[model samples]
Target: MNKKTVKSFRPISWPTKGASAKTGKWRTMRPVIDKEKCIACRICYIYCPEATITPEIEIDYEYCKGCGVCAHECPKKAISMENEVH
Candidate 1:
């Protein structure tokens, strides 16, 4: 019988800035979270491709591309997409 060693999982360390640029600058729409309605489920944080949303539900607009994934995945409908003003 052969025994295999199981490897523990480790998360990747993401860089502060993407290779392209600060993606937020190109965003046409931004996600707005209604804190009053938010339950802090971390759904948006898990689904965000940019990983711009924190576990505390705070969004880092500097890196966020405003893809609307957070708004779409929000079960409570607390996140809404609005046109980015400047």
Candidate 2:
């Protein structure tokens, strides 16, 4: 009996430095975590598409796209999307 073999494909190139991709500049709004209300539940961190939410519950504005996923998913409503000043 003869068996057929399949070849796997991988990405030709990968991002070199960071995940930012300079998306922050396009965002009109930004997420602000209310530390006073935050429960440290990590919901925001998990929902951040850009992975901009840090382990210490800080949002890295440099990469955040203002998608509002973190604010929408926060159970405690600790995250809010505010208009970007600049």
Candidate 3:
């Protein structure tokens, strides 16, 4: 039996700062929530890829990518994607 020699392994560098990348500016469309239509089911929060949706169903536009996943997945159709103003 032949034994293989192990080489040095690189350590993964994890980001210490929380979501420093502000990608919202790159978004062409933004999600707007209708309070009246919203049932606060937290469906949008669960579907948000950027995790910008709060527990209260408020979207943090700073980190939101405007992917529209939330709006699409919204059961109540409370979320709407609107054109972002530059």
Candidate 4:
């Protein structure tokens, strides 16, 4: 297998200004965590393409887009998507 032929896994159309301008920065979105539902499986941390999830059992809101990938892949269904109040 040629290394040059390997397909890349990267995010597309990520706005440089981020979700909005209200935050005055490149903000992604909010990622909500339910401690009751979370089993500490760390799937969010494992599957986050943005590297937004952390091993500290928390989701990095600054990087998370509320994409629901964590919730979709979550075996425990611990994550949820919500609009930020910003």
Give the alpha carbon lDDT tens digit for every residue of 1-86 in model 2.
Answer: 22233233633334554643677787898888888999999978887877888878988787788999999999999888899976
Candidate 3 lDDT, 56-85, residue by residue in tens: 988888778889999999998888899999
What C-alpha lDDT values do all the predictions have? 0.86, 0.80, 0.82, 0.67
lDDT of 4 by residue, 1-86 (tens): 65555567733333563443333124344567899988888888898877667887776665565666777898887777666665
Off by over 4 Å in 4: 1-29
TM-score between candidate 1 and the true structure: 0.78
The CA-based lDDT of model 1 is what?
A: 0.86
Judging by lDDT against the true structure, name the best candidate.
Answer: 1
- Poorest stretch of ten by lDDT in candidate 4: 17-26
> What TM-score, over all chains together, does every model reach?
0.78, 0.76, 0.78, 0.61
Q: Is candidate 3 or candidate 4 better by lDDT?
A: 3
Please rank every candidate by lDDT, starting with the best. Answer: 1, 3, 2, 4
lDDT of 1 by residue, 1-86 (tens): 22233333634333446756778887889999999999999999999998889999999998888899999999999999999987
